[model samples]
Every structure is written in C-alpha cells, then in structure tokens.
Target chain A: MYVGFPHMGNAHIGIRGLFKALGILTIDLPPVNRLTVELGAKYSPECSCLPFKTVLGNYIQALEKGADCLIMLGGCGPCRFGYFGNLQEKILRDLGYDFKMIILEPLDWRQTLRQLQETFSPVSWKQLIYASRLAWGKTVAADTIESFSHFYRARQSRPGIITGIYQRGLEKIDKAYDLASLRTIVKEVEGEMKAAVLPFEPEIKIALIGDIYTLIEPYVNYQTDLKLGEKGVQVERSIYSSRWLKENFIPWEKKKKRRKMLRDAKGYLKNMVGGHGLDTIANAVRYSREGFDGIIQILPMTCMPEIVAESILPRVAEDYQIPIMSLAVDEHSSDTGLQTRLEAFIDLIAQRKKDKKDYFLSKVHEAS
Target chain B: MKTKIGIPRALAYYAYYPMWKTFFEELGCEIVLSPETNKEILDLGVKEAVNDACIPIKLFHGHVSSLQGKVDYIFLPRLISMNTERTVTFCPKFLGLPDMIAALDTDLPPLLDMRFDFKKGKKQGFKGFYEIGKQLKHSYWAIKKAFQNALHAQYEYEKLLAQRVTVQEALAYLYEGKELSKPVDYSLKFAVLGYPYAVHDRFLSVDIINQLRKMGVTPLTADMVSSKRLAAQAQKLPKDLFWTFSNQVIRAALYYLDEEKVDGIIHVTAFGCGPDAMVDKLIELEAKARGHVPFISISVDEHTGEAGVQTRLEAFVDMIKLRREQ
Candidate 1:
C-alpha cells in the first residue's frame, strides 16, 4: 500500500523518511501550488476555511499519482479541522475516487495503533522504534534549520542568500539515509548560518501567532515570514510542528510551557475556544511582555477558533500597548493587498521604535 | 427592588430562556432580556464584533451591548454540551462568548458566566445553578426548588416543540401563558434546518418559516423532531458529529429525506459557519443520492439582502413545485 499525506511545511519529509525506514512504499505528493488551491476551492465547500480546501486539493493530486491510502490527522471539534477527514472522505467518494483514509485522532491511541498495525503488518516493535526516532530526528533537524534561516534571513547583507542556504540544507537533510548523516547535515547548516556576515542588526522584532495550518503553510499565508524578513524584521513563530509533536506524541514530556501559556491566557481568555485560540492570545501577551515590536495573527478566513482569538486580541493589544495585525486569508486573498498591509505594519513598528527611543533619550536628558 | 439579571436573547436563549427566567425569578432576580434583534442592534453587532464572526454571534454581541450598564450581572452561560450521549460541543463562539464579551471595550455589567455541561447528568448543571444561587444569596433548598421549577418549565416548552409548534409561537405562549391557535395544514412540506438562533430569530432567518407558510408550505424544523429519533437517524452516519446543533440539523435533514418524505429541504446556515460548511454538504449529497430530494442551502449573514433571500426561496419552491407536477 502506497501511503500519502497532505503537506504541512516539512512534515511530509519526516513522514516519508519514517515510511522509508520502515521499508514501505510511499507516494510523494506534488508541492502545493496555484493548481492545488484552485482544484481544492473548486471541490470544497465555498465557505470552508483555506486549509481544508488546500488539503483536499493535495489529496486529489496525490491520488492521481497512484496513492491508494491517505493518512490525515484528526481533531475533535469546536474547530472545522476535526471534521476535515469525514468531509473530505465524503467529497472524494462523491468524486468517484477509491482510497482508504486513516484518520489518527489525538488521544485515541488504540485506534491509531490498530490502523498502524493494519497498514504495516509483519513489522516488529524494533522497526517501529527505529522509524519513530528517524522521523523525530528529521522533524527536529528541519525545524532547527528553518528557525536558523529566519534569523539569518533578517540579518544577512544579501536578500536571498540565507533562503538559498536554507533550501540546500533541507535538500541535504532529506537525502540523508540515516540519523548520523541527518545530524551531520544539520550541524553543517547551523555552522554555515552562524558564519554568515551581517551588515546590520534587525530593528523590528515581530511574533507570528495564530492557527497552526496558516501559520506554517507559506503558500496559504502568502509567505508573510519571508516578506517580513525581507523588510529587516525578525519573525518568531509561537507554533511549530516539532514543538507540537514533542508536547503531544512524547508521552514522558511534560507540557509545562503549554500549561503556563494557558495560565497566562486566562487573564484574556478563560476557555479553550479550540484550535490554537488560547495559544494565540497567550503568545500575544507573552511576546508583548518579552518586548516584541509587534504581533501578526494569520488564519483562514472562516476559521472558528481564530475568529474567537481575533475578537479578543484587540484588547490584549491595547492593554499591552503592542501593535497587532490580523490577516484573515482565504483562497481569493489578493497577494498585493497582503503585501501592502504587511509593509505598512512594519513601517509603523519601525517608526514607533524610533519614537520610543527618542522619548527615552529626552527623559534621560531631563533627569541629567 | 430585585437585582437585575441580563439575558441576551440570542444563541440558546430561544430554547432555554424560559428556564433561565424561571430560575432567576425564583432566586429573586428580575431578568432583563435584550430586545428582539433589530437593524440597529445588528448594526451595532457588525461594528463591534470581529469581521469573520457569523451573523448570529455578531447578533449575540449586539444583545450583550444592549444589556451593558443596564443590569447588575449578565447571564451568559457557556454551553459546552447539551446532550450526554455523545461529546457534542457547541460552536467555538458559544464556548468563548463570556470571554469575548468581557474583552469588548464597552462598559459592561459583571457577568454570571456559568458553565452548563449536561454530558454526565443534571448534577453538573445543578451545581452551576447552585453557584448562581449562592451569588444571589439564596438558600440551598430554595435553589433546589428553583432548579426543579426551571427544568419543569423547560420540559413543558420542549413538549410544545414535540407537538410541532414553531419556536416563536411556543416562546410567546410560554412567556405570556397564552393558548396557541390550532395548526393549519399545508399542501407542501419543507424541512427547515438550522441552529435555533438562526432559524428562530426573526431578523436572522428573514422569517423564512412564515414566508414558506404563505406559499402553502409547512416548515419542519429540527426542534419539532424528537431528540431520540434525531439521535437514532444520526447514528446511521459513520460517526457522530462533534457539534450538538450540527448533529441535530444533520439528523433532521436525514429524517426528513428518509422518513418524513418532505418535498424539499431548506437549510439556513450562517455564512462562514464551520460546522455547517461540513454538515450542509453531507446533507446535500445524501439528499441528491439517496432521497432524490431538491435541497437549497441558504447562507445568512449580516449583509444578506432580504430581497435576494426571497427571490432564491421563491425560485427553489417553484422548482420543487414543477418537479412535483412532473
């Protein structure tokens, strides 16, 4: 059985590595592009959020390439994501596609294990352990490289140099056959990123926070991080797939940070509005306290939890005196509009920082 | 003078207001209900609420705004689960409503934000009511009696629904203690599916039920169907929907198509509603394949024009009528 999964940043790379290590055939999905978004929008519910449509489009593309089974993460509601598996299955069936969907629900270990056994029978416990380790290593390496690139991209003298290095780093990590090579590539990339010459320091620091899908998927978000980095702003995203995996999949790992974030979120939001609603609010407050210049909240247009978060975010921004820009994106979101708004927001942050510095200097002068 | 308890006449208010009213009144609190949604209220909601929120949630914001500074405490209960059979959560807006309202920059009364999760039993719900009673300084026995009364009233109100009374008519009768006129038979039956707020609110649904009635069509809503029957019909699906109201609407549509033999289905959903985006498609697909019934999904929002809705409804009804003749 050839397995296929939707692209979530570099998650597919880790997934492919895991399956390969387990000696299984897997179908490489085509990278998400305009065609994927168009196809997804055509088949999806008109008002369904961006992630649902794009993922559906990805599945269709993969299915055409001989993928007989699809693996998708499942959620339990208050968010549209939980219903994606069921809805996508119905849509695909209606379109006359033949495929098996394996929805791995969080906390449903028995179901997950059963599906895993059915898919990979005659596999020993040792192989499972080995494959899991390899997948984890790939994910951590990919995330570390991507994070390093964000810092380097903002500080580098040339515009595209860091991005080029980051892409090459990812390619090398992807080609690595085992843990040793993956570790070597990661270390080499880290060294290269560190040695890069910086012409000037990043003036503006912004925290990216919101729905996990839109935050990670550059295509859906119009590559806001890249755009921000190009404008000499350091972008720190609060949500990362690697961190999420550690918190959720690793049984022994305590979610101390998550608990603390939720506790901080209590001042603004009392309940789990589902999806990363609490995280969005909590991270906004944390980033503000940590003296970030601004916060950008990006989510799919019809996303429920993000809407809730968006509603409460203005107050958080006001209380903390931090500027926030919320971008509600959908398939039809214009690239030019997003770019203009982002540029204006960055300019505003830069101006505010200069004004604050001037004010502080004047106060010091008055004291003297 | 009694302490004023504000209740926004949106969301679950149409279904549960009678109980809340009775319970609070028994606790020596005078209830201040936000007036029926109007253009001004809707405008306020549009201005104050986040742009992406559905019309109903926005209307809820309007209701809350209207109650601001007029009452001592706003009774905005966080309804997590109305049913115990499955983990049927409400929409995210409902779950986070109290926080949303609190975060609003407007001057607001203190909120009695009690959580109502009936998944286990009335024990949890009663505990919430007991907390409300304590806030009002009522005795335990008094709170218990008041809780029993509220439940009885809610039961009676539900009985009206079981007998096929429209929610508006039932609510009027329940509040005013007036007798409802006998129901009139109509030539065509159309199952109207939506959340209680969307369907019951005169402003939100554009009075679709009455319009259907004028066109010689009887509207069958989810509330009219017995909960047990709806649950049973919903069980035919591969898995239970997570949202309680979404599950109800899906089951109602399934029942109407398979059992009620309705001529057509009119599904009124809020624009950008996540649950409806999924459930509506499922119903539409089933209606086409299995039942061969014509289904029209009406997506409502703050900016939806009444004329457009009317035109679409007329066209849908006309097409169904022509199909019947054929």
Candidate 2:
C-alpha cells in the first residue's frame, strides 16, 4: 500500500523516513504550490480555512500518483481542524476518489495503530520501535537545521547562503538510514551554520505566532520568517513541528510549561480557546516580557481560534508596550504583499528603537 | 437595589437563556436582556468587533455594546462544552467571547465572565455556578436553590422545544407562563438548519422562518429536534463534528432527509463561519446523495441585504414547491 500525507515544511522528510523504516511504499506528494492551492480552492468549500484547501489539493495530487491510503492528524476541539480529515474524506469520496483515510487522533493511538496495521503490512514490535526512533530523529534533525538557518539567515553576509545550506542539510537528513547518521548530519549542519554566520547582531527581534499550519508551512505563510530574516530581523517562532508533537504526545514537562503559558495569558485570555489561540496570547506576553521588539501573527483567513486571538491581541500589545500585527492569509494572498508588510514592520521597529535611544540621550544631556 | 446583570440576546441566548435568567433572578439579581437584533445593534457590532469575526460574533459584540451603561455587569459566559461524554464544544469565538468583548476598547460596566463547562463532573459543573454566585455574594443555600430552579427552568424549556415549539415561542412561554399556541398547518416543511443565533435573529436572517410561513411552508429548525434524536441521527456520520451547534444542524438536517419528513432543507450560514464551512458542505452532499429532498444554503453576512435574502428564499421556495407538485 502506498501512503501519503500533507506537506508542512520538512515534516514530509520524517514521515518518509518512518514509512521507509516500516517497509511501506510512500507516495511523493507534490509540494504545496500554485496548482495545489488552485485545485484545493476549486474543490473545497469557498469559506473553509486555507489549510483545508491546500491539504485537499495535496491529497488529490497523491491520489493521482497512485496512493491508496492517506494519513491525517486529528483533534477534538472548538477549532475546525479536528473535523478536517473526516470532511476531506467525504469530499474526496464525493469527487470519485477511492482511498483509505487514516486519522491519527491524539490519545487514541491504539485505534490509529490498529487501522495502520490493518491497511499496511504488519510490523513487529522491534520494527515499530526502530521506525518511531528514526522518524523522531529525522524530524528533530530537520527542525533543528531549520531553526539554525533562521538564526544564521539574519547574520549571514551573503543572501540565500544559509537557506542553501539548510536545504542541502535536510536532504542529507532525509537520506540518513539510522539515528546515528541523522545525528551526524544535524551536527554537521549546525557546525556549517555557525561557520557561515557573520559577526553581526540583528537590529530587531520579532516573535512569529499564530495558526500552527500557517506558522510552520512557509508556502502558506508566504515565507514570512525568511522574509523578516532577509531584512536583518531575528524571527523566533512560537511553535515548531517537533515541539508541537512532543508537547501533544509526550507527557514530560508538558503540564508545567502549559501552566506557565496560561499564567502569562492571564488577563488577556483565560481559556484555551482551542487551537493555538491561547498559545499565541501566552507567547506574545512572553516575548514582550523577554524584550522582543515586535510580534507578528500569521493565520489563515476565517480561522476561528486566530480570530479570537486577533481580537484580544491589541490589548496585549498595549499592555506590554509592544507593536503587534496580525496577517491573515488565504488562497488570494500575494507574496509581494507579504514582503511589503514585513519590510514596513521591520522599518517601524527600527525607527522606534532609534527614537527611544534619542529620547534617552536627550534625557541624560538634560540631567548633566 | 438589586444588581442588574445584562445578557446579550445572541449565541447561547437562544439555547440557555431561560436557565441563566432563572438563576440570576433567583439570586435576586435583576435580569437585563439586550434588545433583539436591530439596525443600530448590527451597526454597533460591525463597528466594534474585529474585522475577521463572523457575523454572529459581530452581532454578539453589538448586543454587548448595547447592554453597556444600562446594567451593572454584562454576563458573558465562556461556554466551552455542553456534552460530558462527547468531546464537543462551542465555537472558538464562544470560548473567548468575554475576551473579545473586553478588548473592544470601550468603557463599560464590569463583565461577569463565567466559565460554563459540563465536561467536568456534574458536581464540578455546578461548582462553577456556585463560584459565580459567590462573586455575587449570594448565600450558599440561595445559590443551591437558584441552581435547582435554573435547571428546572432549562428542563421545561427543552420539553417545550421537544413539543416542536419555536425558541421564540418557548422563551415566551417560559418567561411569561404563556400557553402553547395552536400549530399552523402547512403544505411543505423544510428543515432550516444553522446555529440558533444566526437562524433566530430576525434581523440577521431577514426573518426567513416567517417568510417561509407566508409561502405556506413550515421551517423545522435544530431546536425543534429532541437531543436524543439529534444524537442518534448524528451517529449516521462516520465521525462526530466538534461543535455542539454544528452537530445539531447536521444531525437535524440528516434526520429530516432520512425520515422523509421534510420537503426540502434550507441551511442558513453566516458568512466566513469556520464550522459551517464544513457543516454546510456535509449537509449539501447528504441531500444530493439522497437525491430526493431539495437543499439550498443561504449565506448571511453583516452586509446581507434584505432584498438578496428575500430573492433567494423566494426562488428556493418556488423551486421546491415545483418539485413537490411534480
């Protein structure tokens, strides 16, 4: 059986590694591109969030490539994401596609495992453990390289150098056969990134937060993080795919960290509010308190949780004396428009910093 | 002088108002309801709410805005989930409704933001109410008595709804002790599905129910379907939807179509609603699969003109009437 999943940055690399480890044939899904969005929008509900459309497009591409089974993540929530897999299945079936949909619901791993075993060749306990380790190792290595590139992108002397290295590093990680090889690739990427970084401090630091899909998928968010980095701004995302997986599936340090996040969001937002709305609030407060220059929240247009966060974000900005902006993206979002917004935001932060320095200098002069 | 607690007449107002009204009234707090949707209220909601919010949330913001300065506090409950066994919840907007209202940057009375969840044990659910009562400085026994009375009021309201009474009719009966009126006979019945807030708000929906009535059609909404029946019908779907209202709308629409009880199905969706994006599609697909009942979805936004809604309703009613005659 050929299996497929949606694209989210470098997530496909790890999924492919897992499939390879499990001796399962995997379909190479076309990366989220113009055709993907177009096909998705053409078939999807006009008002469905952007992620659904893109993911559906990916599924269609995979199906066209002879994939018989698709894997999708699931949740139970006030957010619309939990129902995406089921709805997409109904839609794909209605559109005359014959395939199996495997939804990996959190905390319902036994059902998901049973479904997987039923659909694919049975795996022994040793193979399952090996597959999981390889998958996690590749994912963490990919996520680490991506974060490293973000750090070096702002300080690299030449444009696209860090990104080039990051891309090559990911390819190597994807090809690695075992955990030891994956670790070696990650360390090599880190060393290369360190060697390439110029001796320069970024002028502005911005925390990127919002809908997890838009936050992780560079295509969906129009590469806002890279764009800001190219403009000499340091960008720190509130969530990474590996971190999100760990938080959801791993129990260690989850409760304590979650408590602190909720504590930070006390006055602005009290409840979880589903999806990443509460996380956005908490991270905004955290980054502001940590003295980040600004916050940029990116979300799919009509995303329910982000809409709630967007409504309350102004208050967080005011209370923290920070500049916060939310960019809502959909199929209609243009790259140039996003670029202009990022450039303008960076300039505003720079101007604000200069103005503060000038004010402080004048005050010292008056005192003398 | 009694404390006046204002409740916006949107969202959960259509579902749980009687219980809330009884609880507050029993606590000796005077209940102040924001007036129904109006031109002025809609205008206010559109102005104050964030640009990205759906029309119902925007209209909710408008209702809250109107209640300002008239009451001691606005009672905006963050309704997380209604089901104990299932993992269903209210929409995200409903979960953070209090924060949205508080962020409007308008000066107003203090907000009595209450957390309403039944997912916790039954005892814990009432404990949340008891905590709210404590904030009001009510005695423990008074709070317990009020809680019992509120549950009873909610029970009776559901009973009235099970009898096929409209929310408006049920609310009127519960609040005023009015007798049930005679049911109007109709030639065609359409299962009109949507969140109660969007469907019941005459201004937002352009009073489509009454408009259908004028055309000799009766509109059967989710509220008229009993919870047990809704739960059972909802199981027909391969998986459960996350939101309570979305599930109800889907199940009610499915029930009507499967039982061959309705001539057609009309889905009233607020423009840019996150859940209805999935719910409407499911209902439409189900109707098409059945290939018997006619289905139409009417999308209402803040800018939805009365003429547009009327034209669509007229056309839909005419087409379905033709189908029925054939």
Candidate 3:
C-alpha cells in the first residue's frame, strides 16, 4: 500500500524517511503548485484556511496517482486544523475518492500504532523504534539545513544556488537511514552552504512570523522567506515542524522556551489564542529585544488566530519600536504583489538602518 | 456605592447573561449591559477589531468599547472550554477577547477577565468564580449562595428555551415577569442554525427570524433543541468538533436533516468564523447526502447589507415553496 500525507515545507522528507524504514512505499505527491491550489480552492469550503485547501489538493493528487491510504495529524483546539480531516474525508468521499483516511491525533500514539499495524504489514518493535528515530533525525536535519540555507541565501552572491543546494541536501537527508548518517549529511550540507556564501553583506534581519502552515509552505507565501533572503534580508521563522513535533509528542521535551514566549506575550496577549497566535506575539517581542530589523506576518485570509494576533500586533510593534507588515494570503494572492511588498519592506528597513547608523555617528562626533 | 459590572451583550452574553446578571446582582453589584447591537456599535466594532476577525468578534469589541468608563469593571470571561466529558472549546477569539480589548483600548475600565473552563474539573472551574468573588471581597457564603442562584437561573432559562420560547422571549419572561408570547405557527418550519450571538442578535442577523415570521414561516432554532438531544446528535460524527457552539449548531442541523423535522435549514454564520467554516460544510454535505432537506448558508460581516440578506432569504423561502409544490 502506498502512503500519502500533506506537504509543509520539507516535512515530506521526514515522512518519506519514516515510512521507508517500515518497508512502506510512500507516494511522492508533486509539490504544491498552481494546479494544486486551484483544485484545492475549487473543492474546499470557501472560508476554510489555506492549509485545508492545499492539503486536500495533496490528497486528491495522491489518490489520482493510485495511493489508497492517507494519514493526517489532528489538533485539539480552537484552531480549524483539528477538524480538517473529518471534513476533508467527507468531501473526498462525496466526490467519489475511495481511499482509507487515518487521522492520528497527538497523544494517541498507541491507537495510531494499532491502526498502522492493522492496515499494513506488521513491524517489530525494533523496526518501529528505528523508523521513528530516523524520521525524527531527518526532520531535525531538514530544519537545520533550512536555517543554514536561509543564512547563506542572504549572504550568497548568486541567486538560486542556495535553493539548489538546499534541495540536494534534503534529498540526502531523506535517504539517510540512521542518526550517524543523518548527522554527517547535515554537516556536509552545512559545509557546502558555508563555502557558497560571499563576503559579508550588511545583514537586515526580519522575523518571519504567523500561521505555521503559511510560514513554512513556500508556494503559499510565494516563497517569501527565500525572496527576502534573496533580497539580502536574514529571515528567521518563529516555529518549525520538527520543533513542534518534539514539543507536542515527546513527553520529556521541556517547553521552557515556549513558556518564555508566553511570558513575553503576557504584556500584550494574555492567553494562548491557539495556532501560532501567541507565538507570533512572543517571537516579535523576542526579535525586537534581540534587535531584529522588522517582522513580516504571513497568514491565510480569514485565519482566526493570526487575525487576533494581527489586531494586537500594531500595539506590540508600537511598544517595541519595530516595523511590522502583515500579509494576508489566499488562493488569489499573486506572487508579483507579494514580491513587490517584500522589496518595498526591505528597502524601508534598509533605509531605516542607514539613518540609525548616521545618527549614531553624528552623536559620537558631537561627543568628541 | 454599588459596584457596577458591565457585561457586553455579545458572544456568551446572548446565552448566559441572565445567569451572570443574577450572580452579580446577588453579590450586591449593579449590572450594566451594552445596548442591543446597533449600527453605531457594529461600526465601532469594525473600526476597533482586527480586520480579519469575524463579525461576532468585531461586534464583541464594539460592545466593550461602548461600555468604556461607564462601569467600574467590564466582565470579559476568557471562555476556554464548555465541555466536561471531552475537550470542546470556544473559538480562539473568545479565549483572547479580554486581551484583545485591553490591547485595543488601554484607557478602558478595568476588565474582570476570568478563565472559565469546565474541562479542568469542577473544583478548578469553581475556583475561577471564587477568585472573582475574592476580588470583590465577598464572603465565601455569599459567593456560594450567588453561584447557586446563578446556576438555578441559568437552568430555568434553558428550560424556558426548551419550552419553545425564543431566547429574547424567555429572557424577558424570566427577568421582567412578562408573559411568554406563544409564537405563531406557520406550515413551513425552517431550522435556523447558528451560534446564539449570530442567530439572536437582531441587527447582526438582520432580524432573520422576524423576517421569516413576516413571510409566514415558523423559525426553529438551535436553542429549541435540548442540550441532551444536541449532544447525542453530535455523537453521530466521526469525532467531536473542537468548539461547543459549533457542535451544537452542526448537531441541530443534523437532527433536523436526519429526523426530517424541518423542511429547510438556514445557517446564519459570521463570514470569517473558523469553526463555522467546517460546520457549514459538514451540515451542507449531510443535507445533500440526505437529499430531502434543503440547506442555505447566510454569511454576515460588517458590510453585509440587509437587502442582500432579505433577497437571499426570500429566494430560499421561494425555492423551498416551489420544491414543496412539486
């Protein structure tokens, strides 16, 4: 049986590695493209968030490619993500797609394991442990590679080279079967990224904050992170899928970092508003305190949590003395518009940086 | 001087105002309610609230703004979960409504933001109220008596609702001792499903229920169905939906469709509501799969024109009538 799941940045690499170690043949669904967005928007509830539409599109594409089973994570929240599987299953079934859908809720691993055992060829405990470890390693490695690429992308003189290296590195990470090999592959990728960077370029750091899916998925955000990096801005994401998995699934994982974020957000937002709403606020504060240049919040149109964050963000921005630009994306969001916005924002920040430097130099001269 | 507590007549106020009013009044505090939603309030909400928030959230912000400086403390409960058996929560906006208000307008009256969650055991839930009582320096006995009275009022109000009285009618009868008016029955019964805030708020929903009455039709609502029945209907789904209100709305819609109780169902939804986006699809699919009960969804935002809503309602009622004639 061929397995399928939705794409969130390089998350598919980890999923592919996990299923492969279990001797499962996973279908490599094509990356999210215009056709995928079109198909997803066409069938999904008009007001549902972008992740639902794009993921539904992924499932449809996978089903058409002869995959008979799909697995999706479930959330428990005020977030609509928790119910995506239930509604998507009904929609797909209504549209006549005959595929078994498995929704794995967080903290219900035993049930998921039992279901997996029932559906596929039985795997020994040893193999299961090995598979999960490999999946975790690959996910972490992919995330590391992504961060390295983001750093190198801004400093590299040539356009598209880092993206190519990033893609090749992902391919290598996907093939590694154990932790040792995964580490080696990550180091190799890091070395290549280091070698590729040109002489020091003036760094204008921007925090990429918003809904996890929109922030991670390149196609959805028109590759805003990469675009900003290409335009010589260092972009750091607020959350990563691997980090999210570790925080939610691993019982031993200390959530001190997330707690700190909550504390930072306390002055602005009092509660966890579900999704990445609280994270956006906390990360913005963190970035501002660390002297980051600006913040770009990318969210799907009608996203509930981000909307709440967006409403409070202006205050956070004002109090912190940091520039913030919120971009609402939907199926109709054109890359040209996004690109223009990114360029304009970058220019504004760069000019602000220059003005600050000149003012500091003038102050020093006056003191002398 | 009597401590004045402001309760914005939006969101949970539509359902739990009587209980809250009873509790506060019993605690020797005067209650102040933001007026029934008007154009000015909606406009204020739209202006103050985040642009991406649904009309309900925006309206909620507007109500709080209207109460600024008028009351000593604004009551904005951070409603997390309503379910005891499982984890069902309010929309994230509800969880952060107090914070949103505090951030939007710093000069407003101090907010009584209490975290109300039934999922966190009975003791913890009571502690939320206990803390509120302590803040007001009320004795434990007084708080206990007030709590009991509030619960009784809420139970009675829900009973009145189940007895076929509209929320407004039930509230009026319970509070003012006004006689409950029997609603005029028409041949066509349409189950109007939505959160209480969206369905009962006259201005927000463009008085859809009264509009239906004018068209010679009976409007059935989620409130008329018992919570027990709604919960049972919800169990029919693969899993429980995350939000309490969404589950009720969906179950009410499902009950109508499965039991063949209504000729048609209309979902009055705030345009950008996260839960309704899913609930609406589920109900629509269920209605379509059943292939007998017709379903219509009316999306309302600040810009929702009354004429547009009326046109849609008339068309829907007309279509249902024609289908019946066949």
Stretch of 10 with least lDDT, candidate 2 chain A:
A248-257
Q: Of the candidates shown, which would achieve the greatest lDDT relative to the real structure?
A: 2
Error of 1 at A6 (Å): 0.4
In the order shown, what is each candidate's alpha-carbon RMSD?
1.6, 1.5, 1.8
Best by DockQ: 2
Off by over 4 Å in 1: A251-258
Q: What are the lDDT figures for the candidates, one per model?
A: 0.87, 0.89, 0.87
Q: Write the per-residue lDDT of candidate 3 for residues B129-167, one digit (tens) a residue.
A: 788998999999998888888878988888889877888
TM per prediction: 0.97, 0.98, 0.96
Candidate 1 per-residue lDDT over residues A1-368, each given as its tens digit:
88888998888788989999999889887678899999999999988899999999999998999999998888777787877887899999999999899888875769887988887667788998999899889998999898987887889777788888899998888888789999889889988877774767788899999999899888889899899888788999987789988876666553676677678897788877778888899999999999999999998988888988999999999999999999999988989999999999998988998999999999999999
Clashing pairs in 1: none
Q: What is the TM-score, restricted to chain A, for candidate 1?
A: 0.96
Check candidate 3 and list the clashing pairs.
none
DockQ (Cα-based) for each candidate: 0.82, 0.88, 0.80
Q: Which ten residues in a row have the lowest lDDT in candidate 2 chain B?
A: B119-128
Question: Which is superior by DockQ, 1 or 2?
Answer: 2
Between candidates 1 and 2, name the one with more favorable lDDT: 2
Q: Worst lDDT window (10 residues) for model 3 chain A?
A: A249-258
